[model samples]
Target chain A: MSIDNPETMETPTGEALAEAPILTEVLPELPTVMDEQDLIIETRNLSKRYGRLQAISNLNLQVPRGAIYGFVGPNGAGKTSTMRILTTLMKPSGGEAYINGYSVVTAPREVRRSIGYMPDFFGVYEDMKVWEYLDFFAACYEIPEAQRPGLINDLLELVDLAHRRDDMVDKLSRGMKQRLCLARTLAHDPQVLILDEPASGLDPRARIEIRELLIELAKMGKTIFFSSHILADVNEICTHIGIIEAGQMVAQGPIKAMRQQLMPHRVLVITLLGRLDEAKEALLHVEGILGIVDLPPEDGKIRIKVEFTGEDLRMSEMLQALTSKGIPVVNFAEESSDLEAVFMKATKGIVS
Target chain B: METPATRTRISLNPLRPLLRNPVALKELRGRMRGPRAFVVLTCYLIVVGGFTTLLYIAGTAATYNTTGEVDGGTLGRVLFGSVVAIELFLVTFITPAFTAGSISGEHESQTYDLLRTTLLPERQLVFGKLFSALAYVFLLLLAAIPLQSIAFLFGGVDVEEIVISLLVLLATAIFLGNIGVYYSAMTHRTLRANIMTYVTILAVILVTTAGAVIALAIVEGLDPSTSSSGSEWVLLVARGIFVCLNPLTTLLSTQQYLVNQQTLFTFKYTFTDGTTTTLPSPWIAFTIFYLLLSVVVFFATTRHLKRIEG
Candidate 1:
């Protein structure tokens, strides 16, 4: 019932489209919006070079205040290096990064206080129990002794591990350990979270749980910078995605905007009940239809490439001619671009 | 509405949690929970207590024929002397076992980053561990005090001497403790740290002893009465440098106590021949040198720990 509860954040409204159009009618919050600045994280020509090897080169990123940005790249693509530089764990060899307008190098303590960074491969102190582990981190973050117990309890429950509060960290499953790690990162109540492969080695259920938790955090106006190899997860939850290849950002933008920019053309797949030679010959006379690539010899389906020049093109013209000849047009579908296709097209198939 | 009071409470230094306690209660508790610590402490007590009791009985029986009595200070000189020697022997073995595992053990367990990324500074880490090890040694020393106090039951035992001796032992243990910590910080594996620290300590002790022995021999062989005053002065200089080599300086800060009572520094030196010229007091110098060495080792370990990127 309450917005503060995570369940409320998860329940998406089907009537959201109708609700969104009403907000733009009055322009009620324009003056207030301009007062708040953008760019929680910004990098200016940030470069890291190990002798001749450049791990990350000229990385300039602007993560807005409340964006769940996915940083996707293959192994050794410098995602970890960039996270380290932003978190103040490692200094950039060339340029600098800012966290909430504070330079990471010059104001490291402020930057550290503002961001919670979780590296990909981290170990939990097995000797400590779950609560004790969180307690230690809370102490590390300099949380007041009186306030820590309540905060720790709240975080454990948030991660759905409150029942395992007294359990030894080593005994918990890998997923529980990861959730605890996230909870530990939030011990200081940091504004920004830079998670390097937060779901790197989780089971399917655990992966979904992490994804849900991240989406919940994003709704609470937190800036989450996460890197993952799972494109499906990125597609499902990320508001924006940046693809890095060989220390370079190949493509980055809102998913919808990127799809619109990259894919101006549409594909129409049609399956006819009766195959007639007249339907195949009529494909050339259509306007703005680039070319038709036929299905294999075994299948009687044909894929039509529709390039609409000025107005929306019609599949009805071909359907009308085919049906008028007593050939039924059984299946007509539009092929939409998903994140996988966008990633493939953007990277140009060169992962390294 | 109530009016607010105009009082402000300010904390002068807010980062005090990072200072954390140096006593290493966590380390002591862990060590106490294990059987190894108890066994070590037990063995140390038995050896030191048994040795003092045996010496007290022997010295009392041997002096029975004399009318003059053997007093507590004389008994303590013999008993505490052996206790210090055996402690040094145990320390050589035990200090390495505890400290050689510090950094390298963390590296082995892969929990190093857990501590390193925290607000705790590296010097605090080094000294925290060093003081913890020293506390264990101090506990063992306290256990021997009752046995040592047995000598006070007799006459002539000086409490100030006993106190000074314990202080010297604590300082020396701290110095050697840092040596093991420095080695542990330098290596990635505990086994290598253990081996290297043992070898290095052994080498330094042996080389210094050998050099001291040679200098003493040369001084003894020369006849100071027939030699020139310059040769006599050279002998004094050699003997003075020899004081630096003796680990016994660790026990007795004063120069006179470090040099053997039997060995003579030839008295035929200046115009005032036969008037003994005392060597300069080495307490201040040795304390400064060893403390400086400990500081350097702590700084080096901190530097090494700070450079760990991952």
Candidate 2:
């Protein structure tokens, strides 16, 4: 609940988290160390074929521990198929997937215990009360009856559904039901959450709430691997991203790294109240300045955009040089590249 | 926040975990909470009650008009047989409705993927749906026991008859329930599954009986003698095999044993090839056969589910 706690902010080491005594006791049948790999989710040449239609082909993905990985793809580009294979709900026609070191095909039970999966479209028992629904799933995970009450309470509070604990699940709004389903996923306190389109059909406010919840869960050291086509949502929250097109991984990396790779040059917009031409002339002399683009005046002030391929220090030095030139500099800021643009450029609009 | 008192309470409740099968518990809780279950139960009871009263009145009047006195033993047999027969019909009609939609319903509602991802195994999922549906059918059977017991108050119905009838009824429910669950797992559409389940049940009942009857008529024509000879044993064994396969024959044979203390297959067979055998009693044979068949169907369902979902 303490969002700003530094201890909670730090991502726990995979080994340390895997060796938690409570988890070991709850899942005694699973091996102590599934894999020594730093990646929490890994797939090697994972392919799925439905007759002649290949859903996924040679997908090699590595999601590090404690990463909010955004899986992006066009419709019917096999995002769901990949997630299904990873969750052990479906088998790949060829290759394999591993979660927390356990093979999805050979050690599905261990894989299931490590991840909580929420499908794109899921249904709840309408006649069950909210708390009872959670209790049923908790039992499915083999959480002890004695602990279920407390776990259910904490999950309800986390998803903001505590007030509707006694209400029938069907009576809740679509957004509330989605959150309740999220709470159900957290019943066993899984190390990773594989959510498929968690905010697919929600309104703007509901999508924001779901986005914030994912952030909170990441802060608590849970690896969140969710798929979404909503580029805006992924752009705002995802630390890591993987873009798939035509059953192939087109691009994947940290968000910051991806932005840099796709948009190599940074655009710096400088607004000057006076001597705009002098500021532009001075910026042109800076070493990293690739080009200077002219812009129309706003409020009797001129704006010039500089295409700079430089490090942070060089940009600061260029700003200092402009200030030292005695030119009236009103505002100088860099326009951050949008993720949507990067996604559009990376994918070829191919779908399988 | 572990309170010593609450922890002790949990540990002492040994049945807590055993009773908490997620699918069964959820199904039962949902079923009992809804008004539809209550409405169905009420309608079932009313229909049974009305039928029982009608059978009693009709039997009493027929006996009084035909004879100088009303024979309670005959009346008892008539009432018990009618009530058991009605119950068999009800169970056969209702078991498919409850089970055939279980798995397919999950898919239709878009919950099947979520369920498959859980720690619950395929066998547990299939059995959970099976047991939950059977539990409701068993409740319906239990509710009709009072009507069945009404015949016991008269002279002819004995404890053995009631037990045997109940066994046959239960075996029929198990068989039909398994069929329903099997089809549910195999088909994606609930309507198709339910239709196939009923078709399979009808085939088991009607086709086997018809086949046996036709085979018996042909064998009788070949011999053309009403003699109590070894050749007659062939006809008896054929009837026994088909009778064991048919639910109606199984229940009726149990009823006949209660009334006459005779096995369904009485004649012994000694073939010209020097083989000699006597068929087992219909109730016992059918119970074992039905249970074995159920196990086969249950596994088939689980295997199909795993192959498709995994």
Candidate 3:
């Protein structure tokens, strides 16, 4: 896939991610390297106040081009407000934001051209067929009449809604409507997609479908800035993640960098078939063991969480030492290297 | 329902932007498609046509005598008046309904945000909404022309009367149309917009009529023994403002003034003392006043939409 300006240059006009060839791109190509020139979305001390309530406060964000950036936080964390501000649907009370070098406040029209925004709620036009809905939005984005039909076909094909093109928009299932809404966003052939809770109310199957579609778009080199309270969705889909809490950004970078920064060591949870004191004494003096804490015992087995600052080889050696001391190591599972730790920190309001 | 008519290649004929504006095109398509538009047009024609036919039969039979003497001109004028009244009633009632929801309905459905985020300009959005919404009312008015022209066969209704009535009906639609758009922009809900549009219309009718009646009473209270140009001018100004605000008043008053005084667009009002004060005809006043009102309202709606985007 080609990476154009994705901002100042012309829109893709008609390109589907599924049909585009996937390049073997790795972490360096993804965002969180934090180069200023490649940043497609940026904010400087952006703040919004609704009457006396501060919906967003001092929000500084940086999202690079061609990155699927997940904005994760708990409910009422100002995700929607920030998305609304970036989409130019609402004005920011203070500070500034830019999309593709266009000021969100001053050059909103230009910003709008660069970004395709889908709000959390599914808002479809009543009495309109699915194709007509896409057609209407395509015309709205000022796509030429000559290219609208083919463009509509490409968009529907991309979102997997071609079969339901003739169905009434309101008559479709909720998941179908969401896919249609996502398809509508692509009608403009925008470079960046800013989705607010794209899979907020979808069933598990539908959520996975949306997640796969988003990953395909990312592979095709379109930057996606999506907000969700669900950490699991962000963890699975985002190449880069920004954790926000109470309208403030807690942490943002490539997911790997975030994991290393938050927990600069490997965490292993081991379950033992014994009483707690014997296993604890055996692993306490072992080399490469940073700390150990007893978790709730399961089925008369002792469970201990081990924080280790060591290599993969050392983890095996430490396990060997435990068994040599006549200690039973039934389960020695490595903890997932995901966003859960960072999200927990965000939720606890400790990142500030 | 799919209306593929709008799917055709857009033309470059500078006069046809409405066809290009997606909002207007979508609105026009949705309005005209399905059985709804046909049902409305059918119901309207049947009522007007049926009423005209029944009135003609009843009036002709009532005026018949042994010598077959009947004032067909009187019957014709009565038919014209009744037709105008019914059309006015139907139009005034339904014009606001079409536009009252045009903007706020988008808000209720949450599509307004999606629309504003598009590259489409705000003024174009307002224009598209207003133009398509009023298009149906205009279609209704034009369709009734045949029924209105039926009175010409009997005699007293002139081409001028028909033309003037049509103009007044159009101006009335524009007036109510703007009111609906104005309230639709100001309010967030269609029900509130509908109520406000009707309230504004009712208030204008009641206030103007009351103003006219009071001015007439003051003119009557003055001693006719004196040449009070002030009372005459007061009566004329109040009448002008009244006709300007109220379409029914403007139509009927202009017809009477034309028939009795033969004054067309503008003429002088002669004082009892050989002096004259020139004044515009009632329909002219109505046209100018409501059109200016519509322009003001158009700006108000535009400004509101701008603020919404900001």
Candidate 4:
């Protein structure tokens, strides 16, 4: 197969490995993009096409180490497909991908060692108890026999399924099963965790629990790359985010940067003890107040939603100006960056 | 994360993965934990054991010894053949049933990808599934030994004959079981994999037997006056190979040769020109062919899995 990077030239495959014999010579060093050595996962112009349908097209994604990178996209926008390629479960039709320093196509074994993948839909072996299930996977990774018991126990405790360690995997609830699967991905203690729609189909409590688990894992210094169509899940836990639409990344960077790029103005919700029109009238003269809309009053207090392009100092000055007019402001808070706005606006016309 | 030293295993021990395969271990645990394995084993033993008792009773009452004395050796041979035939039939079908779902079931349950991502390697996955599936069948084979040893009480079937029979039975189990694994690797649905495996094995048996029969009929119909050197001899060798291809025919023909004591390892064919040649006996030929075939199937399945993993 031909690759865009002429330096690597030929992709090392089974036949290539046989012909070359020496692995080091056959597998050329994959050039890191823009000298970002911290990128745990990188895909350059990676594309996959099934017949005439292109699942992914010229996709470039870079997830740095120890960053909770949220890959948000509409359905069928190549989230799972890209994750599969990175996990070495599928070959890209074109271009190349790397996990750490290992080329995914040429060095799949290394890539598999570096990353733990949890797919969108997964099932457990019904006959296996929770501990046995973990042990089985641990053995798959060729973990030493003596260490498996300790590792399984540690993993079970981490997922909070330690109390149910002896129960059959089939008996666990959907939420519990998801947690167990997340634990299964950790059987090898991989450097990167690629989870696809981890919180989908979970109840609110379970979703929150999963969110907390991810946060905890991130705090442990793992490079977590997860995909979600649920924007709230992305907005909650992701430090950096990539928004994909129509099989291409439209926006990607730190979550704050992407949010700012998607939304040019901040949303300020102000609650007043006095009249609403008076606050609106005072806000019309404030600097950086692009527009104002009166909101539904809560608890006998008038509320107004303000669209402002400003900093913290500008917001403070505006609040001071409103109270100076005897507007009696009860609350003035700027809305946090809502990834829903980024997801909706970025993936606007793509029909999944 | 695991320490850097233990992250990757660099060993030359080829059997290391197979020695302790998680797939096989997990499969054995799954198979034995349920009542399904026990139920199947019970049914298999009943069929083989039940057949032996019925055959023993019938052989006892038969009038082969017209002098009113029982022919113990003849009765023993009859019982041995009866029991083995039933065991072979059950093993042929039962072996594949255990293996046919091995890989495909993983796909159906959505665990195939999870299993593949690990460092388990493809060959281990294939053989692990094969061993775990055939382990129970092998157990059934071993369990039937007592019923087969009934021949020893009557003093006809020797240990050599018993060994050859078990060898053929083991070969048959492995061949059919590997075929199931082959189809399992090729397909996503277990039911379809099973159907394909059964069809392929049935075709092997029917085509070989029918081909041998039809070739014999055509050769017999040819003019007796004509003298064709090497033609008839080649046909004899061809017929022997064909018979050996079918496990049932191989068992019967090998047993027949052992009873005749004409040859142990080979059959000598005399041509019209008074030249003679020897061909390997049915059991030897059958065992060697199936052993090589099983190896090929194992490698083919591994290669297919590697491709699919991509």
Candidate 2 lDDT, A1-352, residue by residue in tens:
2222212223255453344333222211211222324799999999999889988999988888888899999888889999999988888899879999999999988998999999998998878889888888888888877788888889999999889988999899888988988888888889999999999887544665687788888888888999988776677678789999888898997888999999899888888888867887787777988888878989988888888897887689778889999888888888767787788789977762
Give Cα-based local distance difference scores for all models: 0.69, 0.81, 0.81, 0.83
Ranking by lDDT: 4, 2, 3, 1
Candidate 3 displacement at residue B12 in angstroms: 12
For every model in order, the TM-score on chain A comes to: 0.83, 0.80, 0.86, 0.80
Select the stronger candidate by lDDT from 1 and 3: 3
Lowest summed-lDDT stretch of 10 residues in model 4 chain A? A25-34
Residue-wise lDDT of candidate 1 within B1-310, one digit each (tens)? 2111111123344533432432253455446654878898999898887777788788776644355765544565666666666666767677787898877777777656445545556776787777777778888877877776665676444565566556656656677788788888888789999998889878877776676677667766777477666676776666555555345743543423433432222222232245556544444344556678878888878898776353
On DockQ, the leading prediction is 3
Model 3 Cα lDDT, one tens digit per residue, B35-109: 999999999989988888888888787766567876777678778887888898888889899999989999999
Ranking by TM-score: 3, 4, 2, 1
Provide chain B TM-scores across all predictions: 0.78, 0.86, 0.90, 0.89
In candidate 1 the C-alpha lDDT for residue B89 amounts to 72
Candidate 3 accuracy as lDDT: 0.81
Model 3, runs deviating above 4 Å? A1-37, A274-286, A324-327, A349-352, B1-17, B57-68, B220-222
User: How do the residues A1-352 of candidate 1 rate in per-residue lDDT, one tens digit apiece?
Assistant: 2212222233266354344343223211111111114878888888889888888889887677788788988888889899988877777988879998899888776887788777788777545678767776776666755676788889999999999987878899988988998998888888888999998777555666787788777766678899988676677677777888778788887667777677666666666655635666665566667667665433645444434332334666655655676766667666666677777788855554
Could you tell me how far off, in angstroms, the CA of residue B231 lies in candidate 3 after the best superposition? Answer: 4.4
Error of 2 at B178 (Å): 0.7
